[model samples]
Target: MKTNLYSSIIEKISSDKFSSIFILVDENTEQFCLKLFIKKTGIKSFNKIIIDSGEENKNIDTCVSIWDQLNSFKADRKSLLINLGGGVLTDIGGFAASTYLRGIKFINIPTTLLGMVDAAHGGKTGIDFKLLKNQIGVFNDPLEVLLDNDYLKTLSKEEFINGYAEVVKHSLLTDKPDLTFNSLVKLDLFNDSEYIINSYSLVKNEIVKSDKYESSIRKVLNLGHTIGHAVESYSHISDEIIDLKHGQAIVIGIINELYISHKKFNFPLRDVVSVKKHLKKYFTLIPLKENDMENIYDLMVYDKKNEGSKINFVLLKEIGKPVIDQIVDKELFKESFVFYNE
Candidate 1:
């Protein structure tokens, strides 16, 4: 366990006399990071609740199971929950804790890059509804956050790269002007502990500063998620499925929207080429079928961020500039996919 993560949680939990400690884990995280969590947090004899880990299991049933566990344990308002796992566990657990007993103090111990940089930091907690992503959730801040780089070793290669997408997005939006594509690509991102921790802190601080409630500046965080989630949902339902991690799907969304941005904003060609070149190497372009396109467009319309009939997208003005709420023409959204146009 890293000292920073241990100290961070202690700072919050030590301030109160709690009923008991409760920690949440999914199947994978329990196998990978449980020992370290116990060693560091030292919450011996804490109640442990485990769920099946995947996008498919993030639903009402899982939430109900968690609520039942808390009820059986006699968990009270002062009881603290340490969410120990990836984004799915953190989101579901946070949602359960918030609704349980009208919310309780919880700390996040994220074990994946996707969880650490994005899900673990922000207070956004929820599960998907009828294949839509994060449909029901609460805006509750965690009492503390713990990011230990050691957990990265447990993530699969795809999962590791899945998270890199957000880090890349952060650099594109917030970093110094000198932040270039090549420099980010060449970054020893996973190997160095300091780099990973710094990146987590950087994204966390940026979101916390801008839209702690996810109403304004935090909308930038959804740059690729709007379409990305639609893509994930499409894959989950369709017959000719395309399996895509959230980051990979978001990368595709970035590509499709890049075309839109190029047309609407006259975004620089060189920057577009740079982004495509870096991401294309990792994620192959998946063809979207006609039915897939229609379903995706429908899902995108229901996005929580949409204000009216027009769907709002966050697009780039340049490499380091992000512009939001650029109303996307519905037709363009459909035609942008090669399979749909064909």
Candidate 2:
């Protein structure tokens, strides 16, 4: 925590506004980020609520465990819960803080690259349900979001790539970036972590300011998620398929959706190919059985974004120009996946 960043967060902690404060962490964050945070902020006393790491642990069961911890520790509504990990930590921590004793104040100190750029802000706290992504969740803003690029140094390459996917998405969504999408994707995340993360945070925050509940403009944020989430869900259930990071799956969704965009909206074919070629270099390819289209299709049809039988997608007329609420049939989806595999 830098001096300027610490001023506001420390103000909240030092103030008598809360009866007590609690810090939340998963195993990875506890080992890597906890002490650094404690020493940096100089908070002498607070409760720790530790839990298992990974998306598999992000569910009602975990939420119950968190609630149990808070109850045992005597956390009150006034207590501030500081979630100090990646998306999984913030997702469940925000949910726990929101529901326990009918909502307590919470702050997010996102650790991973993905967490900083996408998961930490936006007030979307959630857990996966019924093998689907973000099926059960709430929209509750945190008291504050603290950012520090120091945490990016602790991430593994795979973890960094998980967030870089969103970086690519945000860059594509905007027409005027300081760096072009090609230059942006090719740059090393660690070398440019501060600028990249700040750019993404600004883009998401700007969009979220207009549509807090994702009614209109915010839907543009889901450009890759419609098909991406379905693939992520499919990976979760399949024994043969390795689990995909949220961003990796989203990258797949972006590539395939670009295919759909070119076919339906005539978004330049060369742009689509170039994006697919570039992103694939960063992410490991997800293996799907040749006959797995129906399985993935079923998952897509069940996507929360879909209405009735038709699946809604956010396609691009061009980079930074998203067309939302476009309904497409299953056959086109199958073709998009085919394009992705190539």
Candidate 3:
């Protein structure tokens, strides 16, 4: 276990305050990460709960199953649930732990780069509803989070690249004007992951501290999420489109929203072009069809961020300076989809 990545959990585990310890894992994590976790931490005695992987399983059914397992194992309020997987696992696992017995102590041991950089650290835990991304969730911080870069080595190139989108999002949100196309320009993965995860993930944590419930400033963190989520939802339902990973949809969301920002707020076109150019190297242009536009648009119309009838978006005047809760016209939102396709 990396000293810096661990928290007081190690000592707490040793102290025997919890009634029992449970490790939650998805199918993928159980196969790939479980052995390494036990070997490294020397924590051999714990109940293991395994769920199927993929965003589709992030629903009430799975939550019920998890709750059932916890009940079967006789988990108590003092019991600890440690989530050992990616975003899907952490989201549903955290949500389960929070709701079960009116919230139990849970820790996040994220095994994916995306989970490490974005999902695991933030207190936002959720499961998708009716294919809408993160439609059901609560803001509850974990007991602790463990980030080990060694896990990144287990990911395939595509899985590794899936997380790059968030890293790019964090860079654009930072004051650093020099932050350009982070991994696209060739970054040494494990060697630089600590600095990248620490710095960029902190950007989210600071914002979250200010607005944990997303009632105000936290909305800025949803920069690409508005449209990104709709895209993700569409992928879940549509036979015409292949499934999109969360970060890939978010990448599309960033591009589309940036177009709206430039059109509405006079955000620099040069910067927009720079972002598109750099992101193009990694994220391909989404194959959005003309017929699919209506479906996608309808999804955004019912998006969680919308204020009654007016759809809300986060736009930037420049990198790091975000204007939140901007009411974008429904027509304009459609235009962004067109702009993204262009």
Candidate 4:
């Protein structure tokens, strides 16, 4: 399906003429995106389903609630669900829509930068199970994905930075030298929204088209996610009141994984330093205690990409070159954190 196209989304929805429409949003998007969507698109009749915002809410329980709402509203197969929010809202809403009545038409209106660049385009729809990220999901593409940069203006600096992490990942994966950290920092999402979003979407779409099921080349997209998901889950499960946002945790993952690349693949240390320096501008290091490392490692073992006891990683051989399914020793995994600390 075509992505990041605003006009096409409106055209498609108008043409579909569905029996009913439903909009799923969190508390955040209800305030920001839904209003603008209503005003701009002149779509006034959809039922509104607002959930609480945050990673904690992306779960089976939330899906059940959304399902109950759809049932109560008597939404049919012809109904269209428009998911409007950040990653959390899109993930859960997509899962809910895909499952309801054996599947209903759905669209994604990504309100956050992260959602626009990463979560909205991918056909992967999922919710976290037992605090592991995307443990339960289906490969279901939305009928259309609408990206409007105006929604990004409502995001706080931290939320914007969270999305920027995925952009950095996209840059690292592609051969785009112009998409460097320095250039990204100066980018005005409002003015350059089409170029940036479409560029990232093109990279992801090309990769996904090759490995739709993530068996081989697609695993390269999981570059920072192995350790990143663990760190994110650890924060959620830990007693710490402050949870790490997905992009914040990912930046940490990117740094330590780059260190692992340096140790295992002899990737250039200078490049690692350059990446770390650029990332540190947006995120502070999350100090991992020995116990935290133990917990995080435990979480990594449950990664969906693993086979039996072996923990597979996608480490970079060089900038823009990712080697997937590399198994790192446990001791080196532990030592990588030490390198990150330094």
Candidate 5:
């Protein structure tokens, strides 16, 4: 919950005593975030490591490269790593830092809206394994998270929309009437950044505090992620990579899961339709062929939320009211795709 920006972060880091300081960025952040970071802070005394920017790069090979760089730089147990990028950078950088020499102190400077609202705040540090999403990771908190809206100024509309999906997901999880479907559809991120970020963070942090290990209440945060991750992984491993972003996949997942909610939990059909209609305005519907469903289902079975053969879902009983650990049959899962297509 402790967030600062720009010079304040530089001052904080400058005052801290550590064996060494390292800044982890992707190719994009190196140009967009790190350069501005150095200029604004007037501090240039850190080792710089850059990786490729994409979900495909979120893997063990990236971790190995990072660990090698840290070792080459003689980063000891007391080294401090500053992750300055979007979700991929924070996730992989945190994972590398956590596992390197047991553990090291780190800070998150999330450049993307999604990173600011969700990925950077959560203590879930991870990387994908074997084309699965977040298949390998550990729970490790950062020294601090520095969120600056300035970083979002340079984002492409696609990137902005990608992050906005999490905002919508968070809004749906809250009872606040101000975050209604109409309000969400009309949201202007530049004007509403402060309210959106703080509100979503508050909800997420409270849920995480109650269940740090994702044993119960925390599962609510995974509302769109179960099917979302499956779709994401499918896009990644498909014969032709479907150019789908994480949030886009999640929006699709939310709509499909909303259908399940309508059928299984008697959630209002009208509400489900309303949510889907609003989301479609911002996200393109990715074509998922019939053959793709089985592959997506196979990926879902490997989800960390599942146990044995049953795939556990966090379905909505109503907007802002989620019922967790609900198991749906495979037949229903296939049918949900049909519902999505219709």
Candidate 6:
């Protein structure tokens, strides 16, 4: 476990001084990463709540189920809930804990790379609605986060690669950008637990600077997600499954929208091509059908960031300099997909 995770969690717990501790885990976390908790902390007597895992299980019903479980445990504001799993567990569990008794202290012990780097750091909590991703959620920070790279050993290649996308994106947008998309796409570091954990923590600390609230600087984190989430939602409905991992979907989204940046914002085309080459090595270019584009485009309109019909995308003027609020043209949006498929 990284020192930052323990320190962050302890700082919050000490500040809050909750009366009871409630830890949340799904079936998978219990199997893979439970012992880490036992070794690190003296918290042997915490209330445990288990829920189903996976994207499909992320819903209001799941939140309700957690709420009911919290009630059963007689959880109060003085109690702290520690979400100990992947994004699904944290998102849904955080929401349950937050809503219960009008918000309680919650900590995130993210086991998956996805959770540690991206999902765990952010205070955003919610579940999907109507097959839409994170359609219902709130922006609230956890008391602290616990990140252990050892947990990633159980991840499949696809899952590891999926989580790697965010790391690549973070690198691309940051000053050092030391971790190239090529190295990550290779997925060779799957065995290097320390490297995996440190990489995620570096990115987390970068994006989660003083702007932990996500009002200004943090919106840059949505660089790929604005379009990726929409594409992922459409893929979920397709019969073929689209074979798109979360990272793969974001890679495509970034590429397609990078094209938008190139044309609209005059972003460098060479940088985009370099990134595409690196990403395409790991992610097969999925051909979006005409209807797939339409459905995904429609979904983008419903994005929470939108103030009106215009979709605001965080586009890069260059590789590291990202600018937001540039409303993407729908016709041009369609054309970018064409370029992507080509």
Selected candidate, larger lDDT, 2 vs 4: 2
Clashes of 1: 0
Give one digit per residue, the lDDT tens place, for model 4 in 1-342. 323345665665676678888989888889887888887777757798888898888999899999999999999999989999988898999999999999998998898889889998868999999777899999999987776777888889778878877887887787667764445656775577667887777778788989988889999889898999888988888985258999988988888898999999998989889888888877888778788888889999998878998899989888788899999888988998987777
The predicted structure with the larger lDDT, 4 or 5, is 5
Clashing pairs in 2: none
| Least accurate 10 contiguous residues by lDDT in model 5 | 1-10
Against the true structure, what is every candidate's RMSD?
A: 2.5, 1.4, 2.0, 2.6, 2.2, 2.9
Listed in order, each prediction's TM-score against the native is: 0.92, 0.97, 0.94, 0.93, 0.94, 0.89
lDDT of 2 by residue, 53-73 (tens): 999999999999999999999
lDDT of 3 by residue, 1-342 (tens): 366444466666666798899999988899889898877677867999999998889999999999999999999999999999998999999999999999998999888889988999878898988767788999899988887878778887788778878887877777754443433245654467777777778778888888888899888888888888888888888998888998889988899888889998898887787887877877777778877777877898888778787678889887788899888776777787777777
lDDT of each: 0.77, 0.87, 0.83, 0.84, 0.85, 0.78
Evaluated with TM-score, which candidate comes out highest?
A: 2
lDDT tens readout by residue for model 6, 256-340:
8888989988988887888788777767878887788888899999887777888888888876778877788789989988888
TM-score between model 3 and native: 0.94
Better of 1 and 6 by TM-score: 1
Candidate 1 lDDT by residue in tens digits, 47-84: 88888888888899999999999889999998988899
Candidates 1 and 4 compared: the better one by lDDT is 4
Q: Point out where model 3 deviates above 4 Å.
A: 1-4, 176-191
Sort by TM-score, best first: 2, 5, 3, 4, 1, 6
- Lowest lDDT block of 10, candidate 2: 177-186
In candidate 4, stretches whose alpha carbon ends up further than 4 angstroms from where it belongs are 1-6, 180-194
